[model samples]
Each structure stands twice: as structure tokens, then as C-alpha cells.
Target chain A: MSADLQLGASFRDPSGFVFRKNGVLLRQVNRPYLESLKRLTDSGLYGELTEAGLLIPHTEVGIENAFSDEAVAVLKPERISTISYPYEWCFSQLKDAALTTLRIQSIAMKHGMSLKDASAYNIQFHHGGPVFIDTLSFEPYDESSPWKPYRQFCQHFLAPLVLMSFVDIRLSRLAASYIDGIPLDLASSLSSSHTRFKPGIGMHLHLHARMQAKNADAGTKKETRGGFGKNALLGLIDSLQSTIEGLKWKPEGTEWADYYSDTNYSDAAMIAKHKLVAEYLGAVSPAPNIVWDLGANNGEFSAVSTSMGFQTVAWDIDPAAVEKNYLQRRADKLMLPLVQDLTNPSPSIGWALRERDSLIERGPANAMLVLALIHHLAIGNNVPLLEIASFLARAGEWLVIEFVPKDDSQVQRLLASREDVFPDYTQEQFEASFQGRFTVIKKDSVPGTVRTLYLMKRRAS
Target chain B: MKKLNRALNIALACGCLLTICQSANAYIDAGSGSYLLQILFAGLLGGLYFAKTAFGNLKAAVVRRASMHKSDDSASHVR
Candidate 1:
């Protein structure tokens, strides 16, 4: 019990390992990596990256609780509210991460250091865009050394982006199944013939896969290996930069991408709903720190929560809608948009089912925002009111939900296509089902509509 | 026995040429080879681009000088 619980995913790196103690996360730097660590900091690479907000800043802490004999230094990095994987990211998010990694590698090369690894998992969406989180990934650059992370970068960023853009956007989620990254051969195979004509795709993916296959089959090691000059390394980085920059994914219209434009709610009703939600948010004591906006289509309500200075996670099932939401999140904002269907969220994946967490593992946020979302979960999805209540109760300390009556055009539209089997889908049933788990403190019927917003606090045990 | 002796001699020569005949003491794989190939390609492509730019600049300079010489002759003749 005294041993610090080391993070499972961080064990791959021998230079340093992250551990948790007394609810605080700390990284223990090993003795063998001290020289490279010094080079990274002393060469001013650390300061430049941190100043530009491209790298996570850390403070060296006293090694009072050095977990192991190899611990040379302990660092406390800025805590990210939520750790989201690359698979959860949209096309642009993944693209930005790839470009950021390339930029880091270029800069590191200039400072006589290079990234030893280029896993997309090393990048995290912080403050609005991707930032490098792995401090131990850098090593002293050798002029003659080939970039060890080259193949990894291609698989992690280049292949996935190419597949997502040229083949299918949903193919980006393949990052979840292939943690190392989508294989190059698979990416090339999945892409269309047209993609082969694109310069970037042809060289980095198609030709790269062929080279990999050839190398694997030959099983030959060259006695006279070629050396890479600094210029050549920089040229490689530049090629990757242009290739990533040239790639683009236009947001295609989906079922919910333009939902707001065709909504039944009048302008006045929408305004009233926003106002009531704001008021309820103000009524909560001590002010909620984090809020999860479930089914936040294009993040209109999530924007409100963010404006109030709450770190908000905007979740939606529609890929296009989530993509649009992420595109609009400002660099200084507190919103993370993700594509997630509530019925089937991201499951525990990777080795031992602990490397990546399930959706519920990272949560129990300070508050939940369920505006215009309950109807879809209930009447549309056939989920019982009690089950929904129980799930919501486990998800947050406070719940702000909106009740859409069956007579409403939105609900009628949902029922229009399917059987109207949800007999207990009413306000009375909702309140009754939630009463055991939450205390309803405030309720208001939105003006100009039958929809009602309720502010409930999870009942104290 | 003669073939074996010849093979040993070749091995010794190769070892002598490659001085420091020990294991690499590092990790290098097919991916490393692929990366080296990329660097080679990038270097070639980049060098070609720089060469083209230099050639274009040289052509521009030569053309400008020729035009200047023609102007000078015309101006002198008019004087």
C-alpha cells in the first residue's frame, strides 16, 4: 500500500514514469535519463516550448516521496481536467496534433535534441488545442542518427489523417483499436485510387507501406548505413509539415450538424431556455467546477457554461456536429467537444482494460447539463426513465435537465418514425423516478414552449 | 579446407574494414531503415528545389545584366 501507484500507460518509457499519490499526479525522473533531461532543459528547448504553450510546463518538486531507487527528480506538471485519447478527436484535432508534433521535432532538432517517440497519445487537448504532455520523450539529437520516431509519426498521425480525409472520416476512430496507430499498409489499402495521386499520400503512406513491406521481407541489415545530416532531418520535418497542412476535412452536413436551424423552438423560447439555465447555474452553491453537456449539439449550451468559467465537456453522438463544435472552440476557452453516443460510449480498451479508461471512469463531474437530450435517450432510444435517472446520478453531483413533453414537435418527430410505446414518459414519472437519487431544488417551464428545465442536486447519502 | 580458409580470410578483412567489431549495443529495426530512406528522399527533393531556385536566380541576373548593357549602349549612342 505504501508503494506509489504507477500509471499503467506510462510504464513504456524508461526515462521517467508518472505515479499518483494522495490524489496528486507526479512524474519520477530516473537517474539514467538525467543527462538527456539536462540537455532538454539546459539547451533552452524546454523554456521555448513551454513559453509557446506547445509543451506542458512542470515544476521540479522535492523528492520527499521518491517511489523508487531510480528516481533522480520529481516533477509536477499542470493537471489536465480530462485526458482524452486521439481516437476521440475529430479530423482537425488529429491534424493539429500531427502538425504540433512535427513542429516540436523541428524545434527540438534546432536545439540539438529530438523526439524519441511520436505517439499521438503524447499529445493532449489542453486549453483548446493539442499540447505535448510527455516530458521524457526527447533525447539528445545525433547528426548521423535516423529519426527513430519517423515510422511511429507516420502511423500515428499521417496514416490516420490520410485515411480520415481521403477514405472515410469515421476511419479516424481506428486509433482506438490500433493503439500504436493505424498501420500504414492498412491505411494505403483503405484509401481510394485518387489518394495515390496526392503527393503527400503517395510518398508518406503508399510508398512508405511498400518500403516497410520490402524491408520486412528482405530481413537484411546494411553494413554501411546512411547518415542523416541536420539539413536532411529538417527537410524530412518540412515534408511532413506540408503534407499535414495540405490535408483537409470539410464538415459534411449530418442529421444534427444543422439541428438548430430546423428546430421547432421559437427564438423567444430558445432565449428563455438559455436564461433559465443561467439562473439555475447561478443558484448552485459554491459554483460547479466542471460540467458535462451531454448531447450538446454544436455546443450552444456548452458555450454558456464555458462563459460562466466552468470547464465544460460537450458530448454529442453526431460526428459532424462534434467536429463543428471542436472547430469553433476558441484557444482560450474551456470547452472540449467529443463525439460519443450515450448508449454506447468509449469502452475500456488496450492491455488489461486499464490502459484506456471507459467513459464513466474519468467522470462524476461536478455538474451535468442535459438540455434537449432526455427525449432522445428516453422516448427515442427506449431507455426507461429510472435507468436514465440512475445513470445520470452516477455521472454527476448535480444535474440540470430539460423535459420535452410528448406533444412537443421534437418529441412528436421522434415518435413519428417509431412506435409510441413509452407510456410513462411524462414529467410526473421523470420527477418521481429521480426523486430518490436527486433533490429537485428549482424548476421552470420555458416560455413559449412546453419544455421545462429542472435543477437537481444529487441527494446526500 | 581451402574454401573454409578463404571464407575466414574474407571475414577477417571485413571485420578489419569495419573497426570496432562488437554488437551495436542499440535498437535499430526495419523502421529505422525506412526512416533513413525517407531522409534520403527528402534530401534529394530539397536539394532539387534549392538547385532550381539558384538556377532561376542566375538566369534572372544574367537577363538583367544583358538588358542593362543594351540600355547603356542606347543611351551612349543617343549622346
Candidate 2:
């Protein structure tokens, strides 16, 4: 393939970028980055890091044309795990990911190299913890350069962590709106009163921000400067490591972190629901099976697909819920469980919407489990039933979902505070609206609850 | 008749509960808010430990115990 492949968010990094050709994901390493690439591969550090689950492993593609100039190396990654932006990560996950990035940097520096940039997107969730994705992020240590990625590290990780720890966890949500990492000015404002005087947070965030502002006004940046020596660089990294250590946030709210206690399901019903989902997945047996469990509070149902040998994506809106899911996943060394708010899912916004894909653009899962979700989105969110049916239809071929009747206690509570305008939300009306998009395969009742589970397969148009 | 009554009561209670839970997820862990605060404090300490080099190496050692990150090289499947 030509070097001119169109990949929007991939254009910047001088090390090279990712592009897909004929369905295979490939990363092309540029000529200038050969030294760092050679050192990274030869150091034996890559294998050690990957096997420890601290790095994502890559395979060299077996194509004659894949390799360009002697300098360019084509690598085919086994799979793209979860594409969670920094904003989508729960407090613990973000904190853990930042640590992982810094650890990788420290190790790289030991090998006479360093990370050229500290973009959070370079870190991705894989087998529980965050792993380095950009194989090209490494560069030969230029002793004359003052650790160029320092400001970026602050923008992408440090400031956000400090603010979340000291001020409010919700402040971390600002990352979703600002793709260039969080604005330092905004972080300076959102930071807690105590953070203003905290040495590490103050120096890295407040003072560093002032320096950036002054530089902008002076019309001169690092362009004229030389890099820091060994002692200075180590000092910078050590101070950052200390500052990151000093900051913290504790997970709060029961359902966000511990969802099972208050969940309305009887133990028997929960097991039965999982059994039904398992049966439905075995029945459809779709190829390339990927399952997304929407509103998966703590990932109980999402694990069903993974246990059956399918990749599963567990999504929920609550950060606490995500934090809990990530904790469990880390304990078991599993690879699923992500944070999301379906109502306001991650969108593509950069130089163009085409820079990165929206959530829907990343999926066409083999199956989906919307267990006890429609009622929440329909009654709770006030989304129309017809639209809900249409959206779910595109998510998968075989969907095992639960329909909570208005008479069911959960639905009744949803109706209690508001007018019951959803007269058409009856089972008959639901079947009629969904029949156009799906074929009902089977339906079962939870042993103790009135919630009805429907196994529907998308009908070929 | 008794079974029907129990079911009815559960329905009524769950309905009210769901209605309330819809807005704010005010569910608490264990018992007192103070206990939850303690657990959170511990989690924060662990987060801090990770920032220090000691925690980083310890985590790697534990992960290497069973070669947890090992993946099959010869096997390739469609996703």
C-alpha cells in the first residue's frame, strides 16, 4: 500500500502511524525512528514487559510489500482490545494507567531512550491494566533535549489525577470534552484548595502552566532550548512519580462500586438469567462473536460471553461501577469491563469527526445482552420504544434481552413519580414494534421475578 | 394465596425502590458511611503505593508467578 493512507488521528507522531489495508491493522514505523525501534526490540525489555501484561504484543506482518524503505517496519497487532479514552476511565483505572505509562518511560530511559510524547491515547486497557500501544513512542535519548514530553504528561495524566484526588472525581470528566488532554487553566481552577499549596501538584501544574503561558507570549518555546542531562531528567521523573504518589481518590457510592448488594435480582433469578444468555449465545453461534453487555453494572452478565469463548465489552455509565468492574477484572486478570454512558457515548471530535470513530462505528457485535436495560433507557431516559428497537437491532444478530412489564416493581417505581404515558409499552406492543427487526427465538421467565427474557435474532431484511 | 401476597409485596416494594434508585445511585457499601470512607482510604493508599517504584516491581513479580500474560502464539482467530 501507498504511504498516503487516510488515518485521521494518526497523522501527528513522527515515529509513524497506524493504518488498515485489506482488513489487517498495521503500524508503519518511519525511517527517522529506527534507532529507538532497534534499541526497544533488542533490549529484551519488550518481551519482559509484554509477558508481565504491562505492554501489548505485536507480530511482524508477513507481506512482501508491507515493509517500505529499509527504515519502515510493518507490524500487525493481534487485536485492538478496548478503545477507552482517558475520560472514560474510572479514577482507579486512570491512576493505574498513568503509573504504567510512567513506569514504561522510566524503563525506556534506562535503555538510553525516552517517550517522545505522553498522549494518553497511547495507553489502552489490555488484560486488566493499561498497556502501551504505540510501539513507536520510544526515541533515542537526546541528552540535549529537556524531556520534551513533560508538559504533555502533565496535561494528559498528572493534572487530571491531582484534580480528581483533591477536588472532585467528576472533574476528571473534563477529558471527554477536551481531546487535547485537559486544559491546564481549567485544571488550575477545578483543583481543590489544598492542591494550590501542595508542592508536586503546584510545581507541575500551576508553575508549569505559567511557564507555558509566558512562553506563548514570548513567541519562543523549547525550539531554542537544549535537553536536560541525566541527573536533571531523573530528577524530573522522580518528582513526577512522587507527586503522582501523593495524590489519590477513594471510590464512593455502593452501586458504583458494589452493585450486587442492592440489585433487585434474587440469587436464583440471576443465575437463571445467565443460563438463558448462555443458551442463546450457544444457539446463535455467530462467527467472530463479540458481545456487548450494555448497562452492565459490575459485569456479571458480560462474563457469560467471555466464559463461552467470546470477546465481551461490559459498558455502564457509573464511574463507581466501572471502578468496581476494573478491580474485579484486574483481580482475575480478565480483559473486558469498560465505562460508558450510552446516552452520551464517546463521539468523534478532532480536526474532523473522522479523526476517531464514535462508539457505534467500532462495533457490529455478533450478539448483545441488554438484560434489564431497555426499561431503564425507555422509562428512565424517556426514549421512544420504536427508536430503542431500531438501535438494538443493529447491535447484534442474537440478542438476549429482558422486558420489564409496567406491573413489575421496577417499572412501577419508574412510573410512580411520573405520568404513565406509555400505554403502548405493553408486551404486545413491544413485540409488534420489534418483530419488524427481529425474530423471537424464545422467551423465559425469571424463576422469582416477573421480568421476562426474550431471545431475538435479527431478521434478514 | 400466601405466595401471591408475598409476590405482590415484593412487586410493590421493588417498584418503589427502583423509582427512587432511578435518579441517584445512593447505594452504600457494608453499613456506616464511615466504614465506606475507610475502604476508600485504603484504596487511595494502594493508589499511592503504585506511584512508588516498590509497588510497581511487586505487581510485576506477582503477575509473573503463573505467567498470567502469556498468550498462544500459534493460534489466530477472527474477531
Candidate 3:
């Protein structure tokens, strides 16, 4: 596979397309967008936005580096360590992203510019916060024009947010199915009757959906006269901002959100486990640049990698846990916390299967921490130990895994209800299954607990 | 109350003009109904925003005046 490749998600906007040349990511600004680009820099909007950390900063490279003849300029943007989608973000992450977009729009308007689109995909978690990555999204403000991205904003940010707040948190996964945004109609239908009383929800979701259906066939191509004034546009942005602000999700009540408090490990064992993981991390040869902590409940152990200065991503299935982790690590620029269900992880989705990378496609991270998560997959989820080992082998190079025996209180709790059909879930079976794929480097029992932790290196294919 | 009434009137007028007046040159669809809703509510929303900002400025001015008075009294005492 070639190291230099054009990003699949970058082609939708005609202003420019992001591509890599000799492994360095660059965006080519087309001739049509040259004027907008000039206006952006000249008006000082770019400087203010980048300074505020609302927009991604980029440096203009020579036009000679253009991928195509139509390119007027090329930009070398500060690279994002990880590209996370809307679906992967927990409630607060998505809300924060939405708020960030609105803030940028307001600031752009002050500079006589406006955002061309309001796609959530344009927002990426960079430098510990959400940032607008699409430089081409800004255009010269038309005082008479309505906010063109209004519908898209509602669908992408507003609808999903309302649904998550009012309907169910799990409905956020609808973002994955509907690549553009969750359909407003679907969101409206799912919403409870009481949501209609809330002015913002009523207008944006229910009324907006009704209007869309009514005008589905209405010819919008014809030219006409009177315009949606600038004040109105500002008002619309403000209204959306307040509406989103009002929509809040408290990260509590979920099982894993309170995992550390409810754990069986003693204080000494907990401290020892943390120390052992750090020790194993230091022992890994050719220190890893990136570390992924799977099943990172509130990112307790992921902190070990972040403190060690490795770019770490904490993935947990619980939204509450991921939200808590995100809130706690807001200042850690090297850490990204996200929600992921290991059973059905994010897959390659969008226009083609290639538009968005699947969970595995993004990795084989330099190191992966599968701490206290084996039993859930093996016994609770009914996945075989061999399959679990095989998946983990493909996910990272150096594996730091904890094997929770059936006798462990947590594992026994899981088996308290279900029949224990898994006779092969022993520690001996686990080592046998993984030994084929990884070479064991270090093994130690966590001081006061029955749990065993191992550090292993991926065997060369 | 008068301002609110005027805003509502303007909104109603804009709603009436929705079918006749439309913007063009959008790359994305910018659905007809969505555009109409914005046009219809533009007057009321804009008025509300204007009123809110105006009230905020008024309150800030009052606070500034009171603070100035306090400083002037303190200076007089010093003299």
C-alpha cells in the first residue's frame, strides 16, 4: 500500500481536497476558493479563530506542491493524532463540538464571513478540544442570505442531541447509519410528546421535519428576490446555541461510570496494579508513540500512558464513562477519550465502505491496554478466548492484558445469572491461546487480587 | 409589548413573502421549507436578539455609572 493517499472524506467540498504527498498531509485550495482564502486571511478571521483554538491552524505551502492543475495554493495543516467520528463521541463531546461550530460561525460573521457547511465530521478532537478543520468552509458573508447550512445543522447536531437528551442516549448511534446526519423526521418521530412544548425542540425538530416533508418536491432552483437578513442569521445561530446549551446529559447512573468505586480490588491492590502497568509500559522495547486503552472506564489506567507522554486514546463502551474520562482529561492534549462497543465496534461506513475507517483500520496501535476486560468478552459476551486473543493480536504490537479468572468476584458476578458453559476460560487456556500470537515478555499477579497481568510482544508474521 | 407586537407583525409579513422570495446560488439543497422557516421567523428572532442586547448594554451602562459615582466620592474624600 502506498504511504501517500488522498483522504476519502475530503472530496465532498469542491473548495479543496486533502491529500498526502510523501506521507505529509496537505490540502489543495482550488482556484474558485482562492478569493475566499484570501478574504479569510486578510480579514484576520483565520488568525483570531486559530488563536482562540476554534479553528485548525495551517501554513500555506507553495502552489508547486499542488496535486492538481486547478489548485491555487496548498496548505500543510497541523495533523490530528486520531480521527474520531460523531458516533464515536459521547454526549458531551458531540455537544461541545456543536457549540464550537456555532462559536466559529459567530466569530466568522464578525469578520464578514460565514460557514459554508455545518457537518459534524468537520469537527475533530484536536489539542484536547473540538476544532473546525475545514478552512474552505468559510465564505464571504452575504447579509441578505439565509444560513444555508441550517437544515444540516439541525440534522447533524440539533436532532441527535435532542434525541439523546429526550429519547435515549443509544440513539446517537443513528449517526453511523445516516452518514449525513440522523434524519430529522426519524428524530421527530422518536421524540416524546412533551418535547413539542420546548420551543427550540418544537421548531427545529418537529416543525422543521414537517416543513421538509411539505416542501420535498417544491422546486428550489428558481431565482427570487428578498433575502434572510444578517441579524436574523445571528439570531438563528444564537437560538441554536441556547437550545443546545439547554440540552444537557449528566454522566451518571451507568454501570461502568462508577466502576472504580464498586470494584473488588483493595486500595493496595489498586495502587499495585497501576504501578505494575507503568512498569510494564517502561519495559516495552522501542517505546510506543501511541497507546490505546480498551475498556477504559473513566480513563483511570489510560492516565498512566498519558503521564508517560504517549498519545493515548481511551475507548469505553459506556457513554457515562467516556464522558467522565473526556471531562477529566480536557487539559491533556495527548489524550482522547471515546465511546466504543467492542462487540460491534465502528465499521467502515459512508459513500463507499472506505469513507470512514473501521476501528481496526485506524490501528494496530504501538501499544494496547486490555485491562480487566477479558472476562466481559469471554464469559459475559460468549466470545472464545482464542478469538479474543486473535482480535487483540491484530489491534496492537505490544499487548498489556489482564486475565480475570472465573473465581474473581467480578467474573463470578457476571456468571451469577448465566450458566457457565465456558469450561475453556481458565488462565492456562488464555496463555495457550495468546502464546501462538504473542511472545510473553513479563507476567505478574496484581498484589492483593487473584487477577494476573501480562505484557507480550506481537510475534512477527 | 409594543416592540413584541411589531416584531410579530414583521414576522407575519415575512411569512407571507416566503413563496415569492427565495435566495439562490447554494451548493447544497437548502430545502425550500427550511429556507421559508428562517425567513418567516427572521423578524421575530432578530427583534428578540436586538432587544436582549440592548437591555444588556443598558444594564452595563447603569453598572458603569454607579461605579463611577463611587470612585468620584472616594476621590472627593481623598481631596
Quick one: best TM-score, which candidate? 3
TM-scores computed on chain B for all candidates:
0.51, 0.25, 0.60
lDDT head-to-head 1 vs 3, winner: 3
TM-score (C-alpha, index-matched) for candidate 3: 0.93
Question: Candidate 3's C-alpha lDDT?
Answer: 0.87
Question: How big is the RMSD of model 3?
Answer: 4.1
DockQ, Cα level, model 1: 0.08
Q: What is the TM-score of model 2 when looking only at chain B?
A: 0.25
lDDT of 3 by residue, A107-221 (tens): 9999999998999999999878999999999999988777889899999999999999987888889999999898777898899988865666767777777766666656552
lDDT digits (tens) for residues A1-461 of candidate 2: 65435467777877777777766678887778777778888886677677777777888765453534543677776576556678778888888878888888878777777888788888887756688888888877876556667767888898788877787777777887777778665686677656655555655666555444433333233332342355556646665776787676666764447667766788888888778888877787544357788888888877777787777788888777777777776744444677777877778767778666777777767788888788888888988778888887766677888888888877887789999877778888878888999999988887788888888888896
Candidate 1, A22-66: lDDT as tens digits: 778899999988998899999999999999999999999988856
Q: Model 3: which docking level applies? A: acceptable
User: How many clashes show up per model?
Assistant: 0, 7, 0
**Candidate 3, residue A257: how far the Cα is off, in Å:** 1.4
Return whichever of 1 and 2 wins on TM-score: 1
Task: Please give the lDDT score at residue A83 for candidate 1.
Answer: 85
Report the Cα lDDT for residue A50, model 3.
93
Q: How accurate is candidate 2 locally (lDDT)?
A: 0.69
Location of the lowest summed lDDT over 10 successive residues in candidate 3 chain A: A218-227
lDDT of each: 0.81, 0.69, 0.87
Which whole-number lDDT from 0 to 100 does residue A323 have in model 3? 90
